[model samples]
Target: MVFWVFGYGSLVWNPGFEYDEKVIGFIKDYRRVFDLACIDHRGTPEDPARTCTLEHIEGAVCWGAAYCVRGRPEKERAAMQYLERRECEYDQKTLVDFFKETDPLRPALSGVIVFTSTPDKVSNKYYLGPAPLEEMAWQIATAVGPCGNNRDYLFSLEKAMFDIGHEDDLVIELANEVRKVLGTMAKEKKLVGSPLKPLKSQTQPQIPTVQLHLLPPEAVAMDL
Candidate 1:
């Protein structure tokens, strides 16, 4: 028997599982977006309401990898353990698994667990990466690099969508549109590109201003 998984988040890239045949699987009415809010892995571990959410992200698409595995009962159990080890921090659930389901031929069973949102919090992820709209698109578009957290799920979606010529509203929102100008300044010592030759803006670029870590909205919420 073969096992398949429809990955949407980091699994799109850094999948720790050993499976053959990685393909671009699709699910109708469901799209991938950087919306899940976390607290332990990406954010501070000391915070409460660390629950993550899979909120409604408009015009968004996430690209995931599916693989086929061969093994016995023990192997199956090991695979499940592996998934938990990788995504245990996210806390996956059957409800989210339903959203990730695809076809049987391309059937991806045993959906990896992930942290879900608080249901009361906003669904859309915090736009902590870009300040403007255009820049956000670019970031999502060319966010991939040799090795990094930003290049996994988000890049998969952005790249595949571009290849398929699927540009929707979420891909062209007002907030992301304004981010274009903010990106040209050069992040710092060259996370993506080199410094200006003329030494323009002698001021060194800030780190937190460039890199983004997804944290639960609760972490930043008021005490009230």
Candidate 2:
């Protein structure tokens, strides 16, 4: 049997393991949500960063990449071990169907193992449940942990989704909000080189003001 793993969030950009083949695919009946709290990779326990999770949403679909692990039994075991260590926070796994982007009408593979955290509010400590995009953005904007800045994670995922010709509206909108908050923080700290340029004051050209570019309606109207 070919071992396959589905990556929807960070795995989309960084699988952190070796795979024989990677295919762009989508999982049905679930949607990507930034409702999980990151106490390790993107934030400390004291201040957690909001991360992505596959939440069960009827008639919904989540676009991501599925990696196929091909090797001898020992090699495949090592690959699974590595992924489990990387995805330690995720406490649940479900066999789901994966549909390839090239032929989305049919299932490319069935019984593929997809890892995800429990959606229950009482059971999982890292599960933050659903919150407003702005609130989630704020958490992701300011939090930094061992891996790197939380904002970088969001930015990278946004770019990755775009690269795959899939515009996740939630990710796109939340990332923009996070950029706004980050821009304000940068102004306060006098940090430069942010992708969103600081506003230039006409009277005081030397002083940089914070002004974030809102995503145009056209951009938001792309395939969701």
The alpha-carbon RMSD values of the candidates against the true structure, listed in the order shown, are: 22.8, 20.9
lDDT of each: 0.44, 0.88
Give the poorly placed runs of model 1, Cα more than 4 Å off: 39-63, 95-118, 121-157, 160-224
Q: How high is each candidate's TM-score?
A: 0.45, 0.82
* 1-224 per-residue lDDT for model 2 (tens digits): 46999998889989888789998989999999888888988999999988888888789999999999986888789989998888777899889999977787899998888989998878898899998877888899989999999999999999999998898998999999998998888897765554565556634546678999899888888945
Task: Give the lowest summed-lDDT range of ten residues in model 1.
Answer: 44-53
* Candidate 2: Cα lDDT at 125: 89
Query: What does the lDDT read for residue 47 in candidate 2?
Result: 94
Please give the TM-score that candidate 2 achieves against the real structure: 0.82
Error of 2 at 208 (Å): 40
